[model samples]
Target: MKKNYFILLFILIITSQACGVSVKYSFTGTNLDPRVKSVQIDYFPNNAVLVEPSLSQTFTTNFRDLFLTQANLDLVDSGGDLQFEGEITGYKINPMTATAEQTAAQNRLTITVNVRFYNNIVEDDNFERNFSHYYDYDADTQLIGSALDDAFEEIIERISQDIFNASVAKW
Candidate 1:
């Protein structure tokens, strides 16, 4: 009798835990749908005038990592429930302002990315959008290349976060 009681108690505990625990924000006004299990992200093509050899790979990897860390989803190459493709459309540097001597004092570096997201399970959520950000560089500052690289990293990070929130955060 005690053995049967313990088995029943264990089963009850498991069932109660499963029922009590919920995935917060897994759904937006709708119940959590288990149709989507895996995701696939393609390499973002860089079509910007100033082509950085590693920019495409960096963006793609960062995007995949963001989704992996933020959402309870898998990453697959093909036949995934979700897929994303994109291109780096713009990369430019322009003078920001004039100095006291009437010369260029600061520069603005801008990067733009266009992304298309598809939820194979839900066609309505699929869409394409372009995102851009800029960083300012002072003429007085040295190491312009490194500074620009850092800025690019930050911009890509923000973009990745925005994409994740838009797709999975359901906000």
Candidate 2:
């Protein structure tokens, strides 16, 4: 009976402290300030020399979706506590490995974006930098049809995750 009383008392103390803590915790491993309740993401235009027409829309949509799915913040059009704006700056394809016949064995597609993050609640969290990710495909297959679509999806997912981690995950 004495041991049960101690365990109950310990749980009560922990629960009370949690309710009073200022730091916010999410199941997604994000530590967001309670004061920051909303975010705004501007359209990210694809400005790469090798442009893919659909890239701009796809990337921008995915970027916004990630934050909404991962965090508890509401999405806003402008003047949010957290704001993100950027442009897709680079998209390049290059040969990776060489085959025995001196032909391309793998091709790497790299996508880079310049991201600017603003935290109105915490000025120190604001930053502007580039985030990039790549996907490699077998040289025998052309980067069209399903292959190209798959690559774009993978690259976009990685880059968005990186941006999220840098801006809010505090990793």
Candidate 3:
């Protein structure tokens, strides 16, 4: 009887595979529809009043990498099951705290992005909104070289994750 049960189980597995039965799994806490097999991220230009030369490309690339790594979706040029398009709308640097001598002690860099997300499979999931985040540095430090890189890394990582949460994770 045990030998017969083993044979039946083997046959069931083979039959499922032959029928092309498959299950979509998500290890990233994603709620993406199985039919959403591809995505397109449009180039996000910097429309900020305070323009950073590299901000546009950096944000776009980082945003694309997030979905590629987490969503397991194909990158397509157009007509994807899921699509993201946006522009950088705000980039501002301001003093946050002041020293006793009336000098600036800390500064903050804030970036705002306006995103338009489309989910063809789930129309209710589509959205257009703005997301913003910031990074703080010492007032004495100039935002250049590694400091700028670090700020971009921190800011973009946050914004991209926010985008992922909104579009893919449904959070």
lDDT tens per residue, model 1, 78-161: 887888888999988788999789888988777899989898877777889888877787867652477757877888988887
Model 3, 19-84: lDDT tens per residue?
443335599868876777999999999999999999999999999888889888999989999989
* Lowest-sum lDDT 10-residue window in model 3: 16-25
Residue range 34-127, candidate 2, lDDT tens digits: 9999999999998999999999999999999998899999999999999999999999999999999999999999999999999999899999
Query: How many residue pairs clash per model?
Result: 0, 0, 0
Q: Against the correct fold, how does model 2 do in TM-score?
A: 0.89
TM-score of each: 0.76, 0.89, 0.86
Candidate 2 lDDT (Cα, 0 to 1): 0.94
lDDT of 3: 0.91
Ranking by TM-score: 2, 3, 1
* Candidate 3 lDDT for residue 48: 94
Task: Give residue 95's error in model 2 in angstroms.
Answer: 0.2
